[model samples]
Target: MRKGILIFTLISFLLLNTPVLAQEPLNNIDLQPFLKLTMNVTLVNTGEYPKFIAVNPTYDFKTFREGDEYLLHNTTDLIQLSKANLILNKRVGFWIYPHEVLKVEFSINIPMDLGELYLQDYADLCYPDYTITWSTKRITYPPSLGVGPLCEVVYPHLINYPILVDLTSFIQVRDPEIVIYSYSGEVEFTITNRGPKTMFAVALPLIPVDAKIYSITPNPDMNYTEYMGKFLPTYLKSQVQNAKFNLTQESVLFEYTDTLLSTMSSQQNLIQNSITTNEDIVDYPIWIVVLGENSSFDIKYKFQWEFTR
Candidate 1:
């Protein structure tokens, strides 16, 4: 019995000291760039005999995109992960042996197409208030209690905020009509405010080359369309020419300022006489006071050529 015990100890020492050889079938676990956007993982059976193993990651096995290509670790042989039947059940082939690691490398590509609408939603879904989750777990059969078998990993990553908010969701443009003939025409359209708060001034930026404004007026919508045109054509023709200053590349601004009021303080004010209540405060859609949250209004821009064609 003592001789038998001595032989066992000697065999154990040799096994411990001997380095495991790389076999023809490459029996070993493999991972590429362990910290990567798409992690390549596989389990190999280094032993000559077949072994049963399974991966039970916390993530749903089917979450991977379809048609992604996988490989048998070091071999040129290609495999399609989506075609693997066992993966749907979150298990590995009972016969998976040396050099074969199940490929879990895949990217989730979520595309947004709604332009500014997408930006608005992205801003609301980013950072401290929201977090997306990803996790994984592993299980091996022929269970050895507490020896080496089960494992789990999970985490949450933060999203970028400042860049997403700068996108164009706050300003909206719609239904514009411009007809110019012989260097004279009218530009009309309604701009809507889609922001959370009130807006002071909105830019109308379109002006014909060397054109002098004839008149600017607000045509009320169906709610109050019966009232006569709120602006005096003769008076507005002058105010607009003076106030309709343009800056290259920037939008033309239609502003209501007290600076323009200084000239009329001693005379009858067009704003006080022609423009009274909030209805007249902003023409049809262009707001003078507060373009309250998400409101639509209109502005009529009429112009004539400074040098007649």
Candidate 2:
């Protein structure tokens, strides 16, 4: 009787402590459109044990241009992604119990196109398509249990899954019309967005030869300011021809003595010379103008000529 009771107790303990073989948790992710980019994720645990799941979100872009040959048309330069400011927490980690449904909510900033220098020949060309994916990993041993996994488990097993969500619908950006004018001492850039969607564009100013920039009316984007401030100061200074002036003076005296009358006569003379130099003073202010979608903005650069001969 005693041996049978001990055997029953041991079996009960083993059955209670052993982990049951069950399928991994199911993940359902829904995304809002681009205008209000938000995500609603639902994690369902259908197992008998609690799951400590960590969901990580990431994004990638596909563009027509690739490699160093098409560096200017890189996907990163064309579009930008960031987290949106919201009251809900952005962190995606929690414990889901057996047969429990856990809902997670987060928001992301709308993808912003930095705008192109020139409109592409085709609307479909030179644009980028973005995809957002969530990688969910189910930790074998919960960190709260103060225990670590007995062995290293490779990912994509029964406990790991990856969910891909296509976001191409929201990223369909239309091209805008850009016009630039170079005047004698001024540069004008105009952008018009005729598409239904808002457009963001970058305009590179064409500065006239030998033009000395005074100021830019209606200040440009902060990116232009930061680029010029950090990188272009020394380069622009080299283009300017600094005015130079030099002055010189010299004096000469002659003395003559007459022996007949023992009279000495002295003559003094002074001469002054002045020199001036001039060159073509030319300065080119690099500009990266940003234009908003469905709107028109004029970026005017006022400058004057500094010529000396």
RMSD of each: 31.9, 35.9
Count of clashes, each model: 11, 2
lDDT of each: 0.27, 0.28
TM values, all candidates = 0.21, 0.22
- Residue 70 local lDDT, model 1: 31
How far is 34's C-alpha from truth in model 1 (Å)? 50
The residue-by-residue lDDT of candidate 1 on 127-187, one tens digit each, is: 2232222122343333333433333221111111111110011111121111111223454
**Deviating ranges (above 4 Å) for candidate 2:** 1-184, 199-201, 223-294
Checking candidate 2 for backbone clashes, the offending pairs are 115-200, 199-293
Instruction: Let me know the TM-score candidate 2 reaches against the reference structure.
Output: 0.22
Error of 1 at 18 (Å): 74
Report residue 308 deviation for candidate 2 (angstroms). Answer: 1.9
Question: Least accurate stretch of 10 residues (summed lDDT) in model 2?
Answer: 155-164
